[model samples]
Target: MSTIEDAAVWLAAADPDPIHARRWIGSARIILLPLGERWSAVKVSEHQGLAAAAALRGPSIHDPSGQCVYFLVAPHTVWDAPGSECLGESYWLTVPTPAVKEPPGPYWLRAPDGSGQLVDAEELRAQLGARSVSAAGAASVKQP
Candidate 1:
């Protein structure tokens, strides 16, 4: 619905600490998984994972190089408190290394939980690291 850049600017000013992350996941390149609606939980699966979010809003690749630095920041479409404080959800963001091999398509970025372990959102937690955060106005239930 909106450009990725616009989302970035909004995210940048998200919280007291808005800078999502920078990553070098595995051998895959990763980027932001843009979604019009806030996500409740994200994981590293195909059917039920962050990849689904990627399907909603993605192809947000900055580069396809694993040799260089790439940002895997969380989408910053959140509700902010004063002083640019984020009071909302964002998955685990990272700065994925460039892809050793060229990424196939948006699919790579869509790999759930950043399959290939290449990407993550900004603030939220990884399924493996800590508990995942769920979006508001949604079910209280969670998934792996």
Candidate 2:
């Protein structure tokens, strides 16, 4: 099965409250919260279009100590599958808010038609030009 299919199966089985599942279908950044090993809360960025780019270039969210964050980037169409149920047709970047203790496994970056790529946290961060923060208050960018 394709990665998207696997993600769909996981979403259906893992996410109990589908209604609250956070998603964005446009040019925006989203902060996600994990539901067990799955994503639960998706907080979309207020910035859109060019504004979204500016936000990404800006400072990282002030997270508490020892938190790890992950990001996933994809086009909006990937959620159009029968069960995906997403709305919109723009580029999207998804991240985990409040961060996770360890790195999140690979996530799906789907297109509007349900085709996409499976990328891990480090790759996503590199693509976004984001810097990884250490517990000791140091930050460094990981080149792809």
Candidate 3:
């Protein structure tokens, strides 16, 4: 429902740690799976094993090229004390990436509020989606 820019602002206001700034600024390859008549996006990590686990659990197709949409995430963190920090709220800024290829089915983006948006393949294509890069390359591609 909100634009990626909006998500960025929200992330910035939430977590302002400079160390995580680099990883949090770019787009993430989200794997989307077909659900009944719509598609739902799956959140994955940089770890291939973890991604595979997520794919298996979601029963979603895992594309070797992990490309999907760009999202700015303000990692969930908690402050144990004044100078100590732990993990807190999880928030992400989701935006469509036109330079990548659209998945076979519709894709969804979940807002920080927990609501989801369903986008059709055609609409994704019209945006000129980008190609996603797989973390493990050809060797990591799996069929499930």
Q: After superposition on all CA atoms, what RMSD does each candidate show versus the true structure?
A: 13.7, 15.6, 15.6
Model 1, position 110, has a per-residue lDDT of 30
| lDDT measured at residue 68 in model 1 versus the true structure, 0 to 100 | 19
Best by TM-score: 2
* Tens-place lDDT digits, model 3, residues 115-139: 2222232322222221124333655
Q: Using lDDT, give the best candidate's number.
A: 1
Cα displacement (Å) at residue 101, model 2: 31
In model 2, the clashing pairs are 77-111, 77-112, 78-111, 78-112
The local distance difference test score of model 1 is 0.31
Candidate 2 Cα outliers beyond 4 Å, as residue runs: 1-7, 17-36, 39-118, 130-144
TM-score of 3: 0.21
* lDDT, candidate 1, 1-144, per-residue tens: 233334333333322334542221322344443332232223332322332333343222322232211223333433322212222253333322333223443323432232212234443223322222333324565665
User: Model 2: number of clashes?
Assistant: 4
Model 2 global lDDT (CA atoms, 0 to 1): 0.28
Angstrom error at residue 68, model 1? 21
lDDT at 37, model 2: 35
